[model samples]
Target chain A: MPNYPKGERRRAEILEAAFDAFGTVGYRNASMVQIAADCGVSRAGLLHHFPTKESLLEAVLKQRDRIDNEQFFAGGTSDDGLDYLTRMVRLVEHNAAHPGIVSLFAVLSSEASDPGHPAHVYFQERYARSRSWLRRAFRDLEQRGMLRPHVQPDGLDVEFLSLLDGLQVQWLLQPDAVDMPARVRAFLSRVLTEVA
Target chain B: MPNYPKGERRRAEILEAAFDAFGTVGYRNASMVQIAADCGVSRAGLLHHFPTKESLLEAVLKQRDRIDNEQFFAGGTSDDGLDYLTRMVRLVEHNAAHPGIVSLFAVLSSEASDPGHPAHVYFQERYARSRSWLRRAFRDLEQRGMLRPHVQPDGLDVEFLSLLDGLQVQWLLQPDAVDMPARVRAFLSRVLTEVA
Candidate 1:
């Protein structure tokens, strides 16, 4: 078995609690004391793990990305872009099972638009990475003639991401009314149809 | 000559300054004192016009709606759904000129997802109204045989709004990189294509 450091474990515990608090009450309203209480750690103990709220939030967002990457991008090394999109659908399906995390992300991303917001730089980098990845994936699909003839693969990347983000917001607002996974699947299938 | 009450003028000035401050710093980080200073008023003086942060936010949001409605839906009472969409494009084009307001709105709407968030109810009602308006407009287009046969007019409403909002976020993040209005127009054109 791989060695597990006690400090690392404590850090993980703090992050989980932070995510819960931030997701439920929002970043601005969530206090560090509350997060520490949630994690069963003294305020000083939590501070040892993360000295600042911004640092704690950054760690939480990174942890989220690591989990998402592991869960959704594990087999994305395959050359098939369609398969990659299928993985994206799976990720959305997974998101449906975890509404709190989705809400946290949606809320943070929007809040991060303000240049002074703590997550603003983090989100900027995140979007840059995501957009470039999708652009590369779509370009690969185009090379194989999988994308529709009229579709500019790179241009569609922005729209695809937008739909994903937008759908999540709608689903969060009205879970029962918005069947997010179904809508995404249908939309993707239509967009990916091979043109004669 | 039209009469302009001093209180009404001051209220409008406060709102404009508030909108600017909130847009720059985001709702959470923006200070009432700064907004009052921007409007050449004291904190208590500003509070005389709007009592609380939440109340001020609500008023700013309402003012945004009034401006948007006046600008985009001014002449949208006709039977053609395409015309309404054209108006939406115009609104987006207009939004491009005001990145601060767009950023403020995007951030706040996401922040409002938490049930207890002050603007939560406001966003909920705003979304419901927007969706319903689009649904009605799309239904009319379908009745007029304008929508593509494969297009479910009612269903497209959410996706349409999603694209609008999603694109706005992306545009705000990379103002020079994302051509939101053009992308929206292209997407709408594709969706509204008449089936042969």
Candidate 2:
């Protein structure tokens, strides 16, 4: 039999419910009651697990951060980051399949500017870490002679990270307009080509 | 002497104040009282120019949009967009100079997604129009054989538009780590190379 704790299973269920509720109604508009109802738990029981509405929101956000890192941000690519590009494109494709979570991040990322907001720190750290990690990956790629010779701005890492982020906003807003996978492939192919 | 009317000057002054207030405090946290103080007008006077908070907010957004479009969004290489790449680089540089307005858009674009929200329709149309403009521009480029022959998913316009939107989010979050203008320029250069 599976050894997962019953409480842990219930907590996961509550977080999933929160994700769905926030996806539909957004963070500010979604009620704790609806989330608890979705989980088939009493409001008090949900509170026992999350303590506060803000905590529940934070937990959901943390869950997404974990998944994003695991999927796109965790690994490195040697051959001009084509693998990373593919992973990122697939990540976007997955995000489109489960758009509720994407909406949650869109809503929370905007509101997270309030330093006291629960998600403020998470997003702040996320942007910082994502930029740094992607920078390192690009550096490793450049050192392997994948990038065109004498590219500036300390490497193409900053541009790559920005383009990755910028493409997500466009894809989320107008999926029909952009095939995220192809766009990444096109840019990487041009920039990451071996010196002939 | 400058021959502007009291009403015209007051309207202009209110917009200026609204820009500063909204830019600093964001759409939600900014107040009419603060806007009135900034313009040296009575709260009642401000309302006479703009009947409601929503009206004022919309007007402010419109003005900022106008400035951005005139200054940045209109960056086509020719009327047919030969200079679109260079023009977009200019836009990013301009945005970096006026981060206050950029921050306002970042906050409001997401807030404006509430169906009934003041800027909701504006953002919806804005995204559509921006993407459309880019697509048409790229279509022209493709027709003229300016872009690579095999560009797909409606060619470079869709991806170009997405990159601009996506880069803005990262630039807003991390100004130093991601040099917005430089990164955007590098990205444009890589994707738009005509190395024939």
Which numbered prediction scores highest in DockQ against the true structure? 1
Off by over 4 Å in 1: A1-6, A194-196, B1-4, B149-154, B194-196
Give a tens-digit lDDT track for model 2, residues B1-196. 2578999999999988887766544566678888999889998899899988889888988898888779865533365655665676777788888877776776666555456566776877887787777777666666776764433425466556656655666666656666766666665555443521
Q: Interface RMSD (Å) of model 1?
A: 2.1
Q: What is the two-chain DockQ of model 1?
A: 0.51
Off-target runs (Cα >4 Å) in candidate 2 are A1-10, A20-46, A69-82, A113-118, A148-155, A194-196, B1-47, B72-80, B113-118, B139-153, B194-196
When summed lDDT is taken over every stretch of 10 residues in candidate 1 chain A, the lowest stretch is A187-196
Candidate 2, residues A86-186, lDDT tens digits: the string is 66667766776665666677656655654555667677788777666656656666777766653543636555555555555555555666566666666
List iRMS for all predictions: 2.1, 3.7
User: After aligning candidate 2 to the native by TM-score, how far in Å is the CA of B48 from where it should be?
Assistant: 3.8
Candidate 2 achieves a global lDDT of 0.67
Give the lDDT of residue B112 in candidate 1.
Answer: 67
User: Per-residue alpha-carbon lDDT of model 1 for A77-156, expressed as tens digits?
Assistant: 67567777788888888999998779888877876676777887787788878788777777877788776555555467
Model number with the top TM-score = 1
